[model samples]
Target: MRCPFCGNLETQVKDSRPSEDGAAIRRRRSCQECNGRFTTFERVQLRELMIVKRSGRRTPFDRTKLERSIAIATRKRPVDQEQVDRMVSGIVRELESMGETDIQSEVVGELVMKALRSLDVVAYVRYASVYRDFRETSDFAKFLGDEGLSDNEDT
Candidate 1:
């Protein structure tokens, strides 16, 4: 592996282990040139997945983009990084298991909303407002009501 710190071409793996979830392999490595240490993770790619946008445009699925969106929703909430990661992983696994090369953007959004609903209510609302395109208070009210969430639950 190439060393990220010094751009060295040579690196030695000092340790290797499966990640906590066993979905990936974590490797600790040191650059042979600078002796700098770094960690790397390897995940299996079941297949190339594409996202079908609302505009009917198809694009390759991006994991980082999904993570960023979820992170924004969970920001400043009690949700920890590990939980966010697990949610992302779960979504990805579900998508992969679907065995479809192309998936609707709405499907992905709904999956995120569902995951956030269970993780944190505030985060769910935050994500819902943007995903559902809430323009008025009534939109939020209707969404809460449809989801069977009472005002008391938000507190």
Candidate 2:
């Protein structure tokens, strides 16, 4: 491994173990030249996935961005971090196993909506508002009605 501190190409792995989620391998290393220590994670990439945006543009799939958005939607909710991670991992695995590197951005959004729907209704609604670009209160009302959820207005 290349050492980030001194740009040295030689580094020795002092310890290695599977990550908490078992989705990646974490390795602790020391630079041979600078003796600096650092940690790195290795994840298996089935292929380089590309997202075809609605604007006729293409961008590389970013897992962290997806996770961040989901986290934001679920923030302050009763949902835990582990459940969020599992949803992210499941979505990634589903996309990878589709056998096509190019996927529509809408497809990804729908996947998140479906995953969040079963996890928490509030989180699902939160994600849907952003993903569907809700612009008014009626938008939320209609969505809730369509989903068979009641809106209790404390008048």
Give the runs in model 1 whose Cα sits over 4 Å from its true position.
none
Q: Against the hidden reference, what TM-scores do the models get? A: 0.92, 0.83
Could you tally the backbone clashes for each prediction? 0, 0
Candidate lDDT scores, in order, read 0.93, 0.93
Error of 2 at 137 (Å): 0.5
- Winner by TM-score: 1
**Any residue pairs clashing in model 2, and if so which?**
none
As a whole number from 0 to 100, the lDDT of residue 18 in candidate 2 is 89
Show pairs that collide, candidate 1: none
